[model samples]
Target: MDYSEAIAIADDVHWVGRYDPGRGLQCNAYLLHTQAGAVLIDPGSMGDFPVVFRKVLDLITPEDLRYVVVAHQDPDVVGSLPVIAEVAPEAEVVAHRETARLLEHIGLRIPIRAVPPEGGFLPLADRTLEFVATPFLHSPGAMATWDTATRSLFTGDLFGAVGAPWSLFAEGAFESQLTEWHEVYMASQQALVYSLDRLMQLDPERVCPQHGSVLVGDQVARANAHLRTLRCGIDRLVSA
Candidate 1:
């Protein structure tokens, strides 16, 4: 794959992540373009910020950026943000309140529009992104964003994987790939299931995780079914 351009996975959501053949894991950043402005999701670490920034610039101007959303305060998810703050200094950050508290410590001067820990939605002039708190899935402040317009769930790390020869879209084996990553990274099965239940209720048409290939069509339902019952973290360790 060329891996030189951003792929539009939805109507206006573009995948702006960098791929590394030297590493097993990778991070993903997304640009949500709207008539009002653009919203960046999980902008990845500082290492990948250069490419990510170039990609964003390819689509929209810095001044047009309205929100910089960090699903969790993990460095990989929020690290590039400090630099991003310098560019789009006026853009408000959207994160869970718990995540917001920790993000502030990073010395980012931009304002944070925190969603309540219980979960809520951020309304934009052209779109509304719903947030779901999936605590302990990856971090205590872990969360997911839902785009109802395209029915694509911007899950922080819920369906992330380390698949070989990574593709922008996942295939039938996506579940097993995701399972390996989740088994070690996710928390107890209860927390995983709780978040999965709420996600299923929304009936997402696609799954766009922060670190893996995008799941579309049936992959959404299939992956959800597999994860809803699969055990991980302490549950898997104990059952073993």
Candidate 2:
């Protein structure tokens, strides 16, 4: 498949990936194209992302790719680091401090910058990216990025479902997706509630997750409700 064609949703500030079938163990990667250039977030594993990377390269030259953001260091997320480095050597790899160490241990040569847990912001020409650290949800240095320009959250592995639609939206029913995500992938009820509450404070208008699809319209409201329900459950448990 033409990786360049993988460009899923294009707004005024960014272009994202729509979940593709038979691409990887998950839906592959998300490419954010901005005036500051392109940022490839969680460029799936080598077995999955290489072809997509090549297509991305074909669409935009190295000079156009400003940064390759690896939200977490899981093989599913950072597995295609070497390929991204080769194509866009000028692009710096951004991750949390612990994730950088793990990447180094794995022998990847990409330059990594540690983002603070409280969240640190990176200023790009047209938009600003902020990294929020959320450890142990799935990985050690796991984090999420918020784009101020678009009010979009690039959440890695958070709020993801296994059998999401190709359009990157909930499609027929969101309840099923939410239930499946919580039941299978989410680490713990408490942790999930905390992460959702943290994210709710960000007030993002759009949610682009690593797996499954992107949630656009009414995303913030929907996400907040999900978090609220979980929080209520936790509160009840604590009281009990």
Q: Which numbered prediction scores highest in TM-score against the true structure?
A: 1
In the range 182-228, model 2's lDDT, one tens digit per residue, is: 55555566776677778778888888777766787785567557643
Score candidate 1 by lDDT: 0.87
Please provide, for model 1 over 121-142, each residue's C-alpha lDDT reduced to its tens digit, 9 standing for 90 to 100: 7777678889998888878988
User: Residue 17's C-alpha lDDT in candidate 2?
Assistant: 43
Off by over 4 Å in 2: 1-4, 12-25, 164-166, 227-240
Model 1 lDDT, residue 13, Cα:
92
TM-score of the candidate numbered 2? 0.83
Question: Candidates' TM-scores?
Answer: 0.96, 0.83
Clashes of 2: 0
* lDDT, residue 58, model 2: 54
Model 1 TM-score is 0.96
Best by lDDT, which number?
A: 1
